[model samples]
Every structure is written in C-alpha cells, then in structure tokens.
Target chain A: MSATLDDLDRRLLWALQDDLPLRERPFAVLAARLGVNEDEVLQRLRRYLAEGIVTRFGPFFQVERMGGAFCLAAMAVPEERFEEVAATVGAFPQVAHNYRREHALNMWFVLAATRPEGIAEVAWAIEDAVSLRVWLFPKEREYFVRLRLRP
Target chain B: MNGEALFVPDERDRALMLATQAGLPLEARPYHALAERLGWAPEEVFARLARLRAAGVIRRIAAAPNHYALGYVANGMSVWDVEDERVDEIGRWLAEQGEVSHCYRRPRALPLWRYNLFAMFHARERSEVERAVAAAAVRLAARFPGAVRAHEVLFSSRILKKTGVRLDF
Candidate 1:
C-alpha cells in the first residue's frame, strides 16, 4: 500500500506503468509529453526509484509461451531459521521474490526455472539445504495475480 | 532460454494495453476511440503497439480465450507428493494437458508436508474440476508410485480486484 501521488506524479506514473519510451533518451520523450524539461523528468524518476516507491521501472515478460516455467512456493520456517533459509533460497537465479508471511507458512517466493525440471531441482536443493519441508503451491489457476498501483 | 529483455512500451502503446486490459469500451474503432482520448494519431497508436509486440512485451493481444470469460468455471489448486527425482517429469506432463494452465514444483513442508508438485485446473463446475483432477492424478500416479498424496480443491469464492503493475514514476 502507498499514499496517493500528486497529479503530476500520477500522470507520469500512469505512463511508466503502462508504457515507457523505448528510445535511448526515453526521458526526453517523456518530458516532451509532460511539457517539462528532460532534466526534471530524469530527476523525478531517480528520486522515485531511490524512495522504493517504484520497485522496478522496467519490462516484464510472459514466460509460458516462451518455454519458461514459474511457480510460487511457501515454507514454514522457524523464526530462528528465517534469515538462514531466506539467504540460501534467495541465492538461486530462478528465485524472483521472497517474503515472510505471518502464518505457519511464513516464507514464500516465486521461482522461474529455465526448464521445467529445473524447478524440481531447485526445490529439492532448498529442502536439503534448509532441512525443512517446502510446500509447493504452484498456481493451479491464475485467476488473478495482478497488482493495481494507482498513484 | 535467454531472450532479449521484454520491451517497455511508449505512452501510446501503454494506453492501448491499459485500455484493453481495464475492459475496452464496446464501441466501434476502439483504437481510434482511445487515440482521441489521448490526443494522438490512431496510426501512431497502432504502430506503437506493433512495436511492442515485436519487442515481446506482449505475448499476445488476443481475447481471453479459455478460462475467465468462457464456459469453464471451476478452478482448483492441485498439490502432489512428488519425489524430488520425479517432480519435473510430472510437471511437464501436467503442462501438456489442456485443462492445466499453471504448473510448478514448490518447496514441501519439512516433515508432514510431502506434497511439493502443484498444478492448477479449470472447468465449468466443481464436478468437472473434480473429474479432471481425478484423471490427472491417475496419469501422475501411473508414472510414479505413491505419487499422489494430498490434493486440495479450493474453489475461488470472490474476486477482490485484478489489474496490472503499478507505475509511479
């Protein structure tokens, strides 16, 4: 959750969230549309990124058709082992996000394996390393997973 | 396989995608319609989208095809007690099924949680989904002994909201 953004910030965010200028000097293009100078556009974006309000201002791909596999997994790690488990699991290139929830299943993350089997290997490796049972909760149906950020 | 980074769309392209995803107005010349709202050329809008597809930002800009809108309604998350050696093999089989949309191997619970392999299936009703899962389980079990352990069919109760990424630039 985030606070409401100012009008100018909202408009700028709407543009970036939906689309970003693909040119080398994308800021210049965005500035022209905003009726602001390129420097101002760049500075605002830098500030936003620094603030963590914009976790990632980049592109994301739909991997299924491209022959990639991804899934979300959670594990009930003891509070004492949270740091150790997270560090070990987070090291994998396939692991996208890892977070601690407030339930018996506290640790969760999304892993994208280049190959389908790679997912199993990663899961097994983590289980062995952590000496904990990992519950694989792959999305049965992606009814909805999108997040709406209205600045 | 490694591919070039997904293309980030320009403003016009973004507008088109957002408009479409947010629920397109059932009006003629939808592209032109949105173009007017954005004060841009419709051709410019189409061209930007074409560039986006070429760049791989969009997998496809087609209709909702199979699940949400169409007839198949019941959705359930299927979990399996697959061995570390056989989970990948089982996941691939699930991926090939028409009813299966999402498939992956997640970490299992340390001692009691033996189910690590999971897949999602959708159908018209709860019965339809149950039948599909029964068939899938049989296929999975035939390949690996004691493959199926606990499969929970949690039906979706409500939809809070569904939208894409938040951009606050």
Candidate 2:
C-alpha cells in the first residue's frame, strides 16, 4: 500500500467520507463543493478504487439491523502454520476484516453473515477445519462505533 | 434476531440492499445508477433507500476512508475486564469519550484472555495511544473503582485481510 498522498487526494478523501448529499448527481454536487470538475473527482475516485487506495466506495449498512451477525474471532497459530491457517480461515466468505495483531491470539478476523446465527456455526467450523482453537468473541453490546480521522 | 427488532426488510428491500452493498455509483443520480444497474426505477430505489435510512438499516451512504493511508497509523484495541454487573453502565460512559472510536462488551476467555470490555483507540504514534490508554485507565479507575480490573492494548501488526463485508445470500 502506497503511503504517499497529495493535497487534492487528501481533500477528496475527507470530502467523500463525509455524508454525501443524497441526490441524483451526488458526485456533481461533491465536485461543485470541492471546486473541481465532476469528471476529475469521478476519475480520481475510480482510480483510488482501482489502485486499492479505497477498498470500498459506497453505502455502509448496519448489517445487524438487517438481522446479520458480526463477530471478532481469533486463533493462535503456530508460527509455522500461520500463513496456511490465515488462508484457510480467510477463504470463508463470512470472514470480512482480518488482521495480524501483536498478542498470543495473533490471527484475528471479523466474521459476518446475513444470517446472524450462521456466524457462530462458521466460527466452529473454522476451528474444526484449522485444528486450532478459535476464540470467538461476539460483542454483547457496542458502546460506540463512530470513527473518523482528519487527513 | 430480537423479538422487538426495529425493522423487517422485504424481498425488494433485500435486493436493493444487496445491490448497493458495495456502494452506489459516483454519479449525479447515484440512485439512478443503482436503479439502472438493478433494473428498477430510480424513484423506487430512492424511496427505498430513504426508508432504509429512516429505519437505521442503512447507517450512512458515504465514503469509507482508509485511515492508515491518512497517517493515523497506530490502531490500538484495548480490552478491559470490568465487573459484569456494571459493565453496561461503564460501557455507556466509555463510549462517550472522544478517543474511543469503537467499544464493545465481549465474553471473557478465562485462563487465557480475561478481559471482556474492548475499546479501540487510534493515533499516529504508539506513545500517543499508550498515553491515551493510560489516561483512559486513570479515568475509568476513578469512575468505576474496584469494578474495573486489568486492561491491555493490542496493536495491529498488519492487514491480513480487509474488505467490504462480503455477504453470500
């Protein structure tokens, strides 16, 4: 992932991340506000997506509200089998965000599914398949979730 | 699902949701683009989106920023072991703090991981995160007394897998 970014890229990012206007030509509105042509804004956004600078560029749903399940799961894989285990567990479509963390339980990932009940079952299956104990930590309650960074 | 679930989506609602899960096209009429792609009328798509937002099914239709790229490199997941009885109350208070981007109540993995309460604090520097964690600890200690036990902040080393929540329906 490239760390270097320019001023316009930064502004575009901050602008898009904000609640965009709910309208027919939202990007055009964004361009109008950013003082750039709609095409330039669109091209850069599409480029960001193509280059993986922005993994996603769209609506964020409250899946839980839609009866979906999301959980944070982890497993302590022996150093030798870490990659294999990661690939194995990550193959599951339910797995969304996975990370390597600095802890005894190092390989962490988020499991999500439209059918909320399926998350636990899939967690169990992942554990069984990997032959490593999986620690499934489903959030009983979320205190806060608002996240934003000033670029 | 809770017995008192806020909203129960219909087939059409699900279709609209699944279609726009990745995102709406960056166009003047984003909903128009969505409708064109999904073979539905723009009015119907727009109306459904409005209803979903009102119902809280759609949290927000906005840009998802890559924080690390913006130089906020340090992401700390702080886990706390708080007394079960007063957890909900403590969680509510912690969630209000500005530094805490995300916080949750998770079950304890006793003998291994005893911490149940988890809050993620992010910053550009590890020392900054640690300082904030320390301050948060002091604040929590003063507020909750003996109910709040030990805590640990686990920093992420790498992005093994990160993507939009992929739904297979």
Candidate 3:
C-alpha cells in the first residue's frame, strides 16, 4: 500500500480511477476536474508510478473481448524445486499472473493469451518444460470482475 | 464455439484492438488520436469502438484502478466446494456483493481439492474478508438449505508476476 496519502492525493486517485478523458490534455482536464494544477496532478501520478503505488495508469482493455483467452491453473510442485518451477511458468508471456498460495496445489497462475490455441500451446510448453502437468481451469463464467478500492 | 469463431474481427478491428489494449494514448480525444495514428477518420474509430463494445469485444472503456494505492492491501482468493449444479446460482449472488471483486466457476481438482467456485475479495484487513466469506456461506445456505460442503480463503503469499493483460500475445 502507498504511504500516507493526503486529502488532495486521495481526491486525485479517486477521480483518476475512472476512465480518463480522451482529449489533447487529459491530465490538464483531469486536474481541472479535481481542482488542481495540471503539472501537480501529472507530477503526483508520475510519483505514484515511480513509487509502485500505481501498477498501471492508462486505458484497460478486456482481452477476452478481443478474442484473447485467460485461465487459472495450478500445479503441485515439489517443495524443493518450487522456485525453479515457478520461474519456468512465470517466464511465458502468456502467463500474466503467477502466485504462490498455501495449498497442496500451491503454485497458481493466470494464463493470458492472444489466441485460443496460444493458451493450450503455452500450457503444454510449461508441462514439458517443467516436468509438471499443468492443470488447466479455464473460466466457465465471469459473474463480475470490477474492482475499485476507495481511498 | 468461442466469440472468436462467432465474430471474426477484420484487419481494421485487429488494429483497433491492439491500439486500445495498450492503454489509450493519455490525451484528449483519445479516439481521435487513435484515428490519427490508425489513418482513419475519428468517427470511424469511434464507430468501430462502439461496435466492438456492443459485441462484448471491449467490455468497457474505463480506467483500471490501482488498488494498492487506494488502501486495499489485503487480497483473498476465496474458493468454495458447493454442489456443482448450484454453483452458478450462488456464484452470481456472491459476485453481487460489495466486497467481491471477481467471481468465477472453474473445474475442481477432485479428491485433493474440491473447490469449484472462486471469488477474490480485497480489503484492508483479513477479518473484513472473513466476514465477506461468511456472508457468502450464508447466501449458499439460504439458497440451497445448507448445501455448501466446504470453502477456503487462500491469501496470496506473494505475487510472483501480475500484469492484467498481454496484448502482444
């Protein structure tokens, strides 16, 4: 989490969390909306990016809509070689997210791909590359997937 | 068949998808900017975007918030082992909750793991997440009269790698 944010910082974050304006000067427009100077808003955002407060600051796309695919898969990797397996799995451009969880199948990852075949191709590559059968658990339905962490 | 097979995006749509996926150039008249770069009229780009959106190709034209910056420090991956037939009904109900950010039905790894439904809840404290999970359990109980078999919340130990999308796939 970001270190103590002031009132103005919070306001800027809350306001920018929505779709940014599609204009010549978005930050300027946003600053106007937030009642702050354009340079200050841009500087704050730059600082946030540098500080890792903001992982990404831009338009977000729904990859699935573009015929891209994603899935959550897990592996019961050997404790000794967990790091090795995780590194192998994480190397793929298709694997957008990889996490170490607490369970029998402790290693979990989300495979993001541009093509349908790309998903299985990457999954198979990982299976042979790491000597572990990757259990593919593709999403059957997405009930909801919107997140807004209020400041 | 998947949406890809059902709706084949043309060369122009592909260009639009690639452009939009990269985070619309942070500028005013982003659509116009996109058009200028794509060598099409602004209206053409706007119309294409609208069509893509309507087709569920672009779920939304919106901002992706940085949760950590906003104080949602704790992340919980709550999984449930509910009756297979009743999974969707309960999953949708739980997804409607304020706490759940994402909910889905995935194939359960049997015998060893039985959880078939997954919902990720984020908050400042683990207790807050537990309360949300408890409420979900209650929702399951209400709908099917105590049919939820088991559930667990797997808080991520570490985020090895996370980037929401890979457009260059």
lDDT of 1 by residue, A1-151 (tens): 2434578776666555555443435556777898887777656665565554454443454544334566676788887887777788777666766655444666766766645676788888889989997666654433222222334
Q: Which regions of candidate 1 fall more than 4 Å away from where they truly are? A: A1-6, A23-25, A144-147, B1-52, B55-169
By summed lDDT, the worst window of 10 consecutive residues in model 3 chain B runs over B1-10
Q: What is the TM-score of chain B in candidate 2?
A: 0.92
Best by TM-score: 2
**Candidate 2 C-alpha error for residue B10, in Å:** 2.3
TM-score of chain A of each: 0.83, 0.93, 0.90
lDDT (tens digit, per residue) of candidate 3 on A1-151: 4467999978887777776644456678888888888889877776776676666665455566656778888898999998888888778878877888888888889988877777888889999999988888888888865666777
Candidate 2 accuracy as TM-score: 0.93
For residues A1-151, could you state the per-residue lDDT of candidate 2 as single tens digits? 4467788888888887777666888888888998998898899888777776677887787778877878899899899998898889878878888889899999889999877788888988998899988888998888765766666
How high is each candidate's TM-score? 0.48, 0.93, 0.86
Candidate 2 lDDT tens digits, B12-59: 888887787776776656788889988998889878988888888777
lDDT: which candidate is best? Answer: 2
lDDT of 3 by residue, B27-135 (tens): 4456777889989998788777777666766655554555655677677899988887788888888888888899998887767768888999998787888888888
Task: For candidate 2, give the DockQ.
Answer: 0.68
